[model samples]
Target: MILAATGMRREARIIARAGLVPVISGGDAGRLRGLLTAQAARASAIVSIGIAGALSPELRVGDIVVGDRVLIPPRNGEGDHPQGGGGERATFGGFAGPSTACGGPPPRDKLGEELLTVLPGARRGVACGSDAMVITAAAKARLYEACGGTLPLIIDMESHVAAQVAQEHGLPFAFIRVISDRADQDLPPAVTCGLKADGSMAILPVLAALLRKPAQLPALIRTARDTDRAMRSLLAACDVLARGGVGLADRG
Candidate 1:
């Protein structure tokens, strides 16, 4: 079976298939790690598929990014490490100090390259995992500058955990992310506090936040619109994967 890890329940629902088990993290890194650990034994390969915030200026909402490698923040000791802010710069072990690469080299012969093959317009780049949401355009810019390179960068909550688990279990891993927010966009406060523990939208909290600050409605609407576009792109990508038999070929 293929293990598909995602941050939100909606994404999990999108990637669900006959041979794939979708795990939702609900935006919690510890929960994600634990879920992947429990599910890794029965899986052949792992793929992190969902909507992600873009850190590259050139990327737009609805664009697909295939992760060549995942840049995860360095852990201080063990257990679950704290999520870093977009402005808080750190390198990965091989590249710099704030983030570290998980699961060796890119999976060219595996799922990563195959995704690009199927989605002809998709771009291959680095995927950065953050425990916290990278909400601001400035934060995204700082992260992009700190983790300087030519390759495009995208940030999300689940890819690192998926990559780590795949490495531990000797399973091939792939990352397929659709850009939900661009580098120039700042996610509204209401949108950030909108998800429930189950990864579903928390309507009450969103409403409360908006009541407290009505000015956020415009930004929230834009975010919602962008998210819709991203979801459509993700659905299309999943359809392509299903028709191409991308993750179903090797059962391992």
Candidate 2:
């Protein structure tokens, strides 16, 4: 079975329509870990599917960013894997030894490339995963600067974790992220305030937030539209994977 990790219920629904099992996390790292751990056995691969925040100006909303590699920021001597320094690198095929490198070379993921072929206008690049959402235009700028202007294609809260899990289990992994917000766009606070503890959306909180800040309605609507387009693209890619019977060979 192909397991998909999505950050929103909308994305999960889209994955379901493609006949893939999706685990929703609402951007909660702990919950995502639990879900992934609980269902890791039957999973032949893990697909990080959903919306992402653009880290490059060239990527506009609705553009799909397929990850050839996932850049996970270093955790300072935390957990089982102590950080020597810098981010840990995880690719579609397997995990590489820890290094401080930002964007050394673009790793080739045939699966990522194939997904791009099925998805026109989709670009392949490195994706950075964070413990939390990359909120605000200023924060996005800082992250780009921190990457030494390498300009990662996109930013999301869950991709790296899923990749890490796949690595631990020696399973293949890939990411199909769609741009939901532009690099220069400052996301309205309400966009995140609506999230529930389990990562699901609470309609009342979202409505309340919108009620307080009516000015943000237009931006919210635009984001919704872009996300819808992204989801459709994800569905199409899922179909391709399903029809193609794509599967990665076991890693040694």
Candidate 3:
């Protein structure tokens, strides 16, 4: 089984469609820990895909990445891990959670790359996973300060929990994320207005918000279109990795 809870919902959707059993997760680190404790034997590897913020000067909307040196707050003074290059990073405000450096350079960090071999034209970079969703310009500015201007390009919730789980289970974890809205993009509040505590759709809030923002249609449509295209690319990659029967050797 391959997991996508480290971040992206799109990853689970695509992986599930490709017949790779997916176990969903979120920012709740404890839940992921419990899942790993219960199901490590059957899991050959793990993958976390979702949205992330860019840290370096190189990254843009619709670009895909899959690296692993995640640093969050709540730390105990540990150095950074040189994981893979091709994952998205986080860029946002204050300390949302404890920072844990989950992935380091393995003797053979081939899973993310091998998986991407099927992604064809998808661009690759370093992904900085964090515990917060970056949605505003002010927040981005603060994130720039927090990460010492090595701020992540994209931002979303939930990735470290997955990484922590993988650590405890001794599972090889691969992470992937796409750029939804960059730090410079001022997304309409509607993107999160109707989001409930459970991340479910709220009819009243959505309807009310939609009625209030008639001018947001174009931006919303653009966002939808971009996300759809990105998701399709992720699905295409999943199809190749799963259906192609690509078996990769584990490097010690």
Candidate 4:
């Protein structure tokens, strides 16, 4: 069976469209690891599917990034502490740890290449799995320098964890991330506050934030529009995967 790890409810819905049961890990690496550890026994492969921030300037909102490799920083000796009570509980938003040069899982080559066949126009590259948001253009450039110009196509929170967990279980792994923001775009400060401890968006925090800075409305609307485009792209990718049987263990 294919197990999909998604960061949001909308992403879960998209992965479900591809005939896999999606586990919502709430954008927390530890929680993602725990969820996969428990359910990976029956899984033949693990897939990380969701929206991601662009790390490469060439990427735009709605671009599909199919990762050949996942790059994540080593955990700071925390040793299996679950993030925010578990994937099920209310959780704080985003990752706060520093990134380092660490090797992560590679997608099964045949399956990985086949994604390009079924889903034309998808970009294939290394995806950086970060514990914290790389929010600004300057940060993305700095990250590129930090990686010695490794040119990560996108940045996300949970893909590395899924890849790492799948490696421990000897399962094949893949990542499909839709770009929700551009490389140079700075996420609104309130975006983080709007996310609850469980990784879901809460209205109260958003309202409070708007009350404090009403001028952020235009940026917020732009983000929402970009997200809508990304979601639609993700849905299209899911349909392609479903039709091609990309992750089916029984496929020859």
**Structural similarity to truth (TM-score) of each candidate:** 0.86, 0.79, 0.69, 0.82
Candidate 4: which stretches are off by over 4 Å? 73-109, 150-152, 197-199, 245-252
Local distance difference test scores for all models: 0.76, 0.68, 0.53, 0.68
Q: Which candidate is the best by TM-score?
A: 1
- Model 2 TM-score on a 0 to 1 scale: 0.79
Clashing pairs in 2: none
Better of 2 and 3 by TM-score: 2
**Candidate 1 per-residue lDDT over residues 163-232, each given as its tens digit:** 7778767777878899999999988877777788788888999999999999999999999999999998
- For model 2, how does the per-residue alpha-carbon lDDT over 87-166 read when each residue is reduced to its tens digit? 54333322333334332332434666566676666687667777766657877776665444463468887787787677
- Lowest summed lDDT across 10 adjacent residues in model 1 is found at 73-82
Better of 1 and 3 by lDDT: 1
Cα deviation of 133, candidate 1, in Å: 0.9
Worst 10 residues of 3 by lDDT: 75-84
Point out the worst 10-residue segment of candidate 4 by lDDT: 86-95
Residue 70, candidate 4: alpha-carbon lDDT: 65
Model 3: residues with Cα > 4 Å off, grouped in runs: 6-11, 26-37, 53-57, 73-109, 122-124, 148-153, 193-204, 212-217, 245-252
Angstrom error of the Cα, residue 109, model 3: value is 4.5
TM-score of 1: 0.86
